[model samples]
Target chain A: MHRRRFVTLCGGSVAMLAAGLRGVRAEPFVDFPKVRLVDAAGAPLKAAALATNDAYVFHYPLRSFPCFLINLRKPAGEPREMTSEALAYTWPGAVGTQKNIVSYSAVCTHELSYPSKEGSEIRYAAEASPLSGKPGMIVCCAHDSIFDPAAGAPRLHGEARDPLLPVRLEYDPAEDAIYATGLAGTWLLDRFLKSYRRQLIAEYGAGVYKEPVGATSAAVLLNTYSGGAVSTC
Target chain B: MSECINRRDFLKMGGAAVVGGAAVTAGCASAGPAAVSAGFKAALPRAKGPRLVIVGGGTSGLTIAKHAKKEYPKFDIVLVEKRDMYSSCFSSNLWYAGLINLEFLADHSFLDAARNNHYIYFNATATGLDRAGRKLITSEGEIDYDFLVVAPGISYDYNRIGVKDEDTIDALRTGYPGGFISPTEHVTIRRKVQEFEGGLFLQYVPNGNYRCLPGPYERACMIASHIKKNKLKGKVLVLDANPEITIKKDGFHAAFKELYNGIVEYKPGSAITGVDLAKKTVKTEFDSYRFEDASIYPGVRASTLIEHLGLMDAKSPQKEALISQLKYNYIGDERVYVTGDSRPHPYSKSANTANTEGRYVAKVLAARAQGKDITWYSPRTVCYSMVNANPPEAISVDAGYVLNKEGTAVGGFSPDTKLFEKRDAAKGRGTLEWARGMYRAMFEG
Candidate 1:
């Protein structure tokens, strides 16, 4: 039974509080629900369009080249299990029994290369060098940063300090399409909230942004929107 | 963005008309009747002090003048620059990507920077070097210097690419601009790229050590990204004179493969022999192909100022001004210093190194003015190459130098001083900060 907690982080301050648990799961902090993963022509992503080891790159909520989707089912290979604990949501077996497919943020945790298309020419981990040993590894071509998609896209090598953030996938069997419902991390969520907050303050007034519930502290938002110019040292 | 707009608006409005090519502006204006002090305004009370004359007000020159004034209040510093404005080629790739405006790449007023620092800003070119007389000859008059620093960047050698005649050179420059170092050329390249309507977009990279090693590759990425994003039906062909990539091999090769894919085509060892202006065709050793528009980066060397000073040794095939590592002094004269891209050194020819040397030279000169002992200082350089277009993520090379047994600055030995070649997502984010930080320190500090 996973517990839900409100985590608040500012420029240099952090605090968290647990809500009364009643078998409720954590809500997706990242704003992936509204974002439609699209092809180069801005059309919705279809599950059948991707072959095994094939993936597509798209811009998500905050930044361009944010997320990517991969089809894990191979022609003559055994079905592999998803090893990533970062998977927030998955396609139900009833939806054409799709258990081997997954999607992860294309932005590399190491240097943010957007390996989906900007970083490398290879389409899948199985095609890349060194990382080819792993079944679901995605390589960030910029620094050779590798991530294991089956295991929540964790960093396998290179300088990326964190794993690729996972986006919750929802398969619509009727449309044979996959839509991103939510995300597993606070990276883009925090940026979105702070940017949204700034836009709000600029459009309305400072008084109108009345510190919503479960919101990060104002100081944290200030630093997030500060464009990284404020030097702590 | 606000500050950038405010400072750059004037340059967009007028700076374009004030200067032509680097050559046209390398002559001096008439010397005014009054003996202007440091501000270049009017006659002021003359004081007996050691004079410091710096040639070329680029990164190194400006930095030296600003630091020298702050350090030694008594020394008279004179900055001799050909143009009133400066266009930085350091981050011009961003401009090509449409991430930054062309106006932001140009600085309209070194005079303002000098005025604020109380340094004499002379809008003139240094034509000849009278090393024996300890004077610099310009169109206006001869200006004497107690200590001289030359930071006159680089000049392209068109003849190396079979462009011998002035008409052919001018045609090549006007038709296909090599947006390597100047502002006007950068704008021309930007306009050409922006106006490109889905055709064969060709780019030529030179063979030898150029201004920025990864610059051509980065531009190719940006151009391909723009085409891909806009859904423009075109192909970007990169013709390399060298057999392979000269630097950042892994990252660039990956970028070409992943991001551009079908949109970009890379051809190695395709050295351009000549270009047919009438048909827009580029002839290489291997093949001849027609191009809709092109960016041809010609072979580069130290600025003409170095040639005028007779700093290059005659026997060397590649002409570069020889200089000491510690002093950055011209090989023959200790009092005359040649820093930045103009000097031949193992260190990369970059603005960061230039700025580092500028500050160091200023400190060394201040110590010399005070009759104090000065020691060698290692200069460091950092270059950030942005890979992704929209998100603006970047990779970088950070290198530091240390004095060798012979006192020449070479690549550093220790772990902390060693070259950092790997890319970092954090470093990608840090690129903008690094650029902003350096610009702020150089201009606003």
Candidate 2:
């Protein structure tokens, strides 16, 4: 038993005596039923899913890459075991832009972990510069993190520049959920710095080096270095 | 920076914008006639030469500097580090168990290591790198590095794991994210662990590859051992990042069950989606849960430095490894080498591996300095994974020289459970001895 489930189970029992006298909501502890670790096809099930499909897209505009936007048209009453081979979405519905629904690999081209969504902006774990075939530029906020969406560069920046391996996902007809099958090799994309370098030049312009005005404008473009300066409009 | 922001704020925001690859609106708020700090400007170093700068003072950069000095005695090796004192994360668990003190784990300066080897050491931050000029531009002045090796250790994606924001990094008083970075966070987390009496000490692991594959389990053992020894009323809930774990489950189970028994609870296959700080609530894909002290380990990526340098290779096992220039790689630029925990090596992110890689990279450069067709030292890694609380189990693997082809070398790992061995009596002690030597090799200087 994971420690949380055990605590929830124990917490439930601790509150059981009180419930006998009067109906009550348990302390809302972690309740993990002893579900199988994986499904028959050997895939992981969702430990938690949103109650509604609208929850798929996060509202925070500042979210970084590798952060997930979980949504479900309908969800199960409890967290259940999921199989790796579970179907995600049927072809017709999942293809938001294309004809069929294709799975996307959330792992950054940099390291394999999901991108860390900072300040609501999901910063790409790797640079988002396009590699060759992958689309979408997921930029990591901290470093030279930029990934090109048009061509997912296997390795975004720094070292690891492999394609963002895709996940074999399909749309579920019954639940309207996107399920994953196996790991898909990542698509290649163009590098991300072209646009990144452009942004700084465009935003700050040539006037950035002047006394208070230039420094202020440049700072606006570079917060960590600028110290969050206010513009003198 | 917009109409509402100031000059300083604009610069900070602009830097962030440039970093994020966002169309930064460098629009500044009209703060009238601001004066730039002369002191800040004057602090810049007044030296000029082919300067080599390293940001991190931890295992990776420090080790590289040691060898780099031996190779280039004349080149100015400038080490810009943030931390004054360094502690061994490799042996940090012992501190939690009251086996060691901060002093015993404290790291030494490169001054000793670089004796006769002239290098400037500064406590500053490197903002950007101009690879073409081989320059490391810091808040101070630009220090040109013919060779730049970046190994800034694990910088968390706190907000991604639902910590809220970077500022909140200071707000959280408990969990693993607490002290993983600076010593302050460590002190804060220690207090939370001390204050808590019972309930569930839930440590949520995020999905996919993260820093230190077996870290959560090791931490769980440490936490559970402490709880059992102290006889706390609570059990430890380990919400794994994925089903099963990177470590051997059987051994992990045996250790936890034998030592912790009722004190630790293990949850496999659950991913932490979000965290509610105020309610101390952790929400997963399946359910909404609450905890007394929640330590959420969010998803990971290459360190900010690695990200900034644009050196990721998704296809390769060594995400942090610099592929050849045929791949237009950043490797061997002025013979630049990145090692230790910072690099996205395929092996378990253990100190053991970091130590091994540090030496391996050092050897490669040393051999290169000696003008020999070097290739004897390949990158290999071994990890001492703690199952319950007993010393730690060992998992070993290698690549390049052994696992892979391509006259190159790097770190590696495997899913095979047998790779992990139950440490025998003497072997366990031997592992500790190895860890001690590694720390000394890098830090004793």
Q: For this target, which candidate reaches the highest TM-score against the unseen true structure?
A: 1
Where is model 1 more than 4 Å wrong at Cα? Answer: A1-233, B1-48, B403-405, B409-429
Q: What is the TM-score of each candidate against the true structure?
A: 0.60, 0.53
For model 2, what is the alpha-carbon lDDT of residue B23? Answer: 13
lDDT of 2 by residue, A100-160 (tens): 3222334334323232111111222121122111223343321122443223223343223
User: What are the runs in model 2 whose C-alpha is more than 4 Å off?
Assistant: A1-233, B1-51, B71-76, B116-120, B159-178, B309-337, B366-373, B386-420, B423-428
Local accuracy of candidate 1 as per-residue lDDT tens digits, B94-123: 888787775656643676667656678888
On the 0 to 100 scale, the lDDT of residue B79 in model 2 is: 76
User: Per-residue error at B35 for model 1, in Å?
Assistant: 22
**Predicted complex 1: CAPRI docking category:** incorrect
Error of 1 at B3 (Å): 37
